[model samples]
Each structure stands twice: as C-alpha cells, then as structure tokens.
Target: MSTTVTQQPQHSTLGECKRWLRVSLYTIFLLTGQCTATLLGRFYFDKGGKSKWIATSVQSAGFPILIPLLFYSSKSTNHDSSKIKRKRSVMFTLYLGFGLMMIAMDFLYSCGLSYLPLSTFALVCATQLAFNGVATYFLNSQKFTALTLNAIVVLTMSVILIALNTESEDSKDLPKEKLLIGFFCALAASATFALHHSLLQLYFVKVAETGAFSALVRLNFYPMFIATVGGVVGLLGSGDWRSMGKEMKEFEYGRVSYVMTLVWTAATWQIACIGMLGLIFEVSSLFSVVVGNLELTIAPILGVFVFHDKIYGVKIVAFLLAIWGFLSYIYQHYLDDRMANQDKSDDGLQVSKGEEQI
Candidate 1:
C-alpha cells in the first residue's frame, strides 16, 4: 500500500511534467514559426514580390508537408472509431466554409503586410485579443475575467496609440489612403482570425473529439487544401501568374532568393499553424491566442533590426502597453492553473482519507 501511494504521486508528477513539456515545445514552435514567417513575408514584399494571391497561396500551399504526418497519424489511430461521424457532404461543407474563410483572412493579411510597416502591422494584430474576447463570449460562452477585460482595454489603447502616431517614419513614404487601407485590412484580418478560432472551438465541441494527433492534422489539412486551391484560382484569375517570371527576375535578391523566400514562408506558416492547433487542442482557443500574441512582442523588436523599423517614443510606449496587457492575461492563466492544482490536491486527499477509513 505504501508503495502504491508513492508510485501514484510519482506517476502524477511525471504526467504533469510531460504535459508542460509539450506545452513548452508548442510555445516555442508558435513563437519562432510565426516571427520568422512574418519577417520572411515582409521580406518578400520588400524584395519585389507583388502578387497578394501568391503570398496568400504560400500561406496554405505547404499543406503537403502535413500529408506525411496525416498518414502516420492515420496508421497509428486506425482503430479509433471515435473519429468524425458526420456525413461526407456535411464534412465537405465544413471544410469548404473554413477554406473560404482562410482565404479571406490570408488575403486581408497580405494586404496589410503590403501596405503597412511590419512593426505597425504586428501592433495592429494585437487587437485580436479584444476580438477574441467578444467571439469567446458569444460562441464559446466564455466569461471575461477582470484580467481579460483589462487586456482588451490595454491592447485597444496600444492600437489607438499607433493610429495617432501618423508622423511615424515608417509611414512617411506611404500615402495616407494606403495607410488607411492597411489599417482596416489588418483590423479585419484580426477579427476574422478571432472568429475562426471561436468557430473552430465550437466545431470541436459539437462535432469532433480531440483525442489524437491525427485529429489536429485533419483539422488543418482539409481546410488548407481547399485554401490552396482557392489561392491558385485567384492567382490565375487575376493574371498574376503571367507576371511571375518578370517579378522573380526583377527581385532585388535574384530569382533563387525569391523562390526560397516564398518556400520558407509557406513552411514556417504551416509550422506555426501546427503549433497553434496543438495549443487549442491541449488547452483552449483563448490560451492559443495568448501565446500567439506573444509574437507581437518579438516581431516588432526584430523588425527594428531587420527592416529598420522606427521605434519612436509613442511606438515604444504602445509596445510596452501591449506587453503589459499580455502579462495580465498570463497572470490570469497562472491563477487558474493554481486553482486547478488545488482542486486536484483536495480530491487526492479525500481519496486517501476514504482509503484509510476502509
């Protein structure tokens, strides 16, 4: 009996260690993949890549990388009958709907990246938390804690500060109209991203079970496949396909760099998506977005060095406010974790007392 008690604690500790290790790995993937992908994306535009469809296409065109993982996951979980039980037509519709949404979000983001400076774009993206809080309230039925509300307000202030800083050196060359377009497009993309996460969480709750890694692959794979196809159609329909050779030849870094930039952008975005999905599966959509927002901190700092993005006084303050808001959200999660552990400990104590009485 003593051995059993000792082994139970050790086993529980091991399981927790494994869970945290997984979360840490996922966080690393999310941070590195997203920051690198964004930088590469901005680099593409800076170096003469003009087709937004091409940019959007590359975002999901790397779905092929997920294929091998899908195959492995399928082989490992073939006996798991608790998979998606919906009709084929229904599943197709869901995939199509999500695919179209992904296309819209990607295109909007591409537009933002094309017109805005990378640092401003990253700061604008922080508004996703506010949009996400709203979506979570309506779709996921999540209540807002004080910390979350504070995060929403503080993040909004960060964006407002950016908006007021019109004399920013980054925007000196950009026409006001284009700046407005970039601002609104980035804002729309942020809201769409939030909606996507909430709806995905709802789908997971109502129709799908999140038990296997294969489930994560499928959730990403089909929608990305459709998005890739849509991107191709748009590229062709827009006649950008014809100019691809000219664009590459004129690229500042030469043809090889052009191709490699798009390729790596595609690869890194997929890596980031995998990490984002892993977090959503492991925790909640809100938690996933919080980790994603961490990129806001890293990307801008990198932008200063790579792109020579100006971090003037107002922008710096805005950046600090963004960090403050993110920390508030993190603290809330820390408190929740503490409460959960306390509950688990109480339950274990009750079980032990019952065992002793018996």
Candidate 2:
C-alpha cells in the first residue's frame, strides 16, 4: 500500500511562544497603567490638586524604578559604543534643543489637562498617530497607501467627536482663554512629539546600533533636561514658593504613599509596555501596525470604563469606523504576508532541486 506524506508546518519554539505570551501580558498591563496615569494626571487638576505637583511627582518617582531595568538591558546587549563617537558640542546642542522642546511640550500638555476631560484629552492626543504617519512618510520616505489615509481620517474623526461631546459633570466655570491656550499647547506638543520620533528614527537608531546605553542616553537626555527645567520654572513661577518647596521636600522623602503607589504602577507599565512592544516588533515584522491599532482602539475603551467616560452614539459609530479601517489594513497585510511566504517556499524548493541534481 502506498502512503501519502504531508509536511508539518514549522512552529515557533516553545520559548518563543512563551516570550510572546509574556509580552502580550506586559503590553496589556502597561497600557492600563499608562492610561490610568494619564487620566489621574488630568483629573487631579479638576479636583484642585496642582498639575505641576502631579506631573513632577508622578514622573520623577516613576522613572527611577525603570532605570535599573534599562541599565540591565543595556548591559546585556553586546553592542559596542566606540563606533558612535560624535563631537561633544554637537551632542550637547542636539540634546539641548531636544530637551527644551520636551519641556515646552510637557508644560503645555500638563497645563491643558487642567481644563480638558480625560476622554477629550486622549482623543486629541490620538491625533499623534495621524501626525506620525504623515511625518514618517515625508521624512523617512515611508510609503502611504489608501489604508493609511483611511486610518488617519477615522482616527481624526474619533478624536473630534469625542472632544466636541465632552461634558463637565461638576459644571464648574472654565477659564476659556486658558483652555484655548492649553489646546494650542497640546497641539504644539503633538507636533513636537512627532518631530522627535522622526529625529530618533534618523539619529537615535544609528546610535542604538552601537550601544543601548548610548541610545537611551541620546534619546532621553533632551527630555530629562526639558522636564527638569520646566519643573523648576513651574515651581518658581507659581508664587507660593514656600508651599512648593514643602511639597517637593515631602515628595523627595516619600511622604506621599498614595502618589508613590501610582508612580510604581506608571514606571512598571512604561518599562514593561515599551520593552514588550519592542520584543514583539523584533519577533514579528508586522508588529508596528498591530501595536499602533491596538493603542488607538484600547486607550479609549479604557477611558470609557475606568473614567466613567461615556461613549455616545457618534463616538460609537466613529470608533466602529476606525475599527473597520484597521481591519482593512490588516487584511491587506495578511495577503502580502501570504504572498511573501509562498515566494520564499518556491525559492527553497528550487534550491533543493538544484542541489539534488548536482
């Protein structure tokens, strides 16, 4: 009797599968923490807590925990730093510019949160993806497709609808002038963030290829500089120097347990979420689009449940449209992947036949 033989597909290693599982878990948790920190930072101002205190306290405490992890990861990578030597003045200038922009953006954004609802803030911030997409295409020569345009439009609509319908439960009077100023600030922040991403893609990637520490330092030096400067300026400019000093002193010594707890959550999420997404991208080529769409879809869902932000009819419809647009992009990608795999298999088969004949 003749028996038919079938090829079993090559599966990813158990360790690889486990790694991806861990990444997924980390991603979900990190996203939750990120969204929570963002909402907390925004809501605090509404409740009479100072925005400066919230931003500084949360970020300062949150970053220290992740520093060790980042250091450890940097050490583990075998990349060497000698190849990335740049003139000290050039590096300093780059970071100085970067830092100033970061400080300005953060100050503006944090100030905006004082007036904007959590949902409204998130929706406006969501425009970053669209901005990034356009910027990437022009700066990096990344190709634009119909799906990309559709995704951008859908995301923009989602943000606009959410912003227009935003309600204030307390009905407290808002300083409209300040609020408008804050909105422009947020818009400026978004533009800066987009520009920063493009610059990193151009320069930071090259530095990272030499050493992770160099990359991290290069990436963060400007932001940290910006934050420190802004925080100091904010503290000094608030008029109650004594109270600001006292709060900062208490913050340094860890007197604020509740705030510290929140900071822990933020730090853990920041490192783990970013690390996991990086790992996912390393493992799968299409991880970029997956991560982008996931963020756009999940963040608003989080806002709805965690903040008691309502998803009205227009928002619901807009969100559905966004999802549909993402699905279309994914489907096209699937076809592309299938075709690539088929071509690879054909090449392998031809190589095997040539070897057999020889």
Clash totals, every prediction: 0, 1
- What are the models' TM-scores? 0.86, 0.70
Candidate 2 residues 118-233, lDDT tens each?
A: 55565666666666676766765655567756656665666665556654432335777866766776777676766665655555433345443435533453456445666666
Q: In terms of TM-score, which candidate is strongest? A: 1
TM-score of 2: 0.70
Candidate 1: stretches off by over 4 Å: 1-10, 80-87, 115-124, 154-167, 172-183, 310-324, 351-358
Which lDDT value does model 2 have at 297? 53
Model 1 score (lDDT): 0.81
Per residue, candidate 1 scores C-alpha lDDT tens digits across 73-109 of 8787744343345455777898899899999999999
Residue 100 C-alpha lDDT in model 1? 92
Error of 1 at 13 (Å): 3.5
Please identify model 2 stretches exceeding 4 Å from their true place: 1-30, 53-57, 79-81, 84-100, 115-123, 167-176, 203-205, 210-233, 236-258, 261-269, 272-319, 329-358
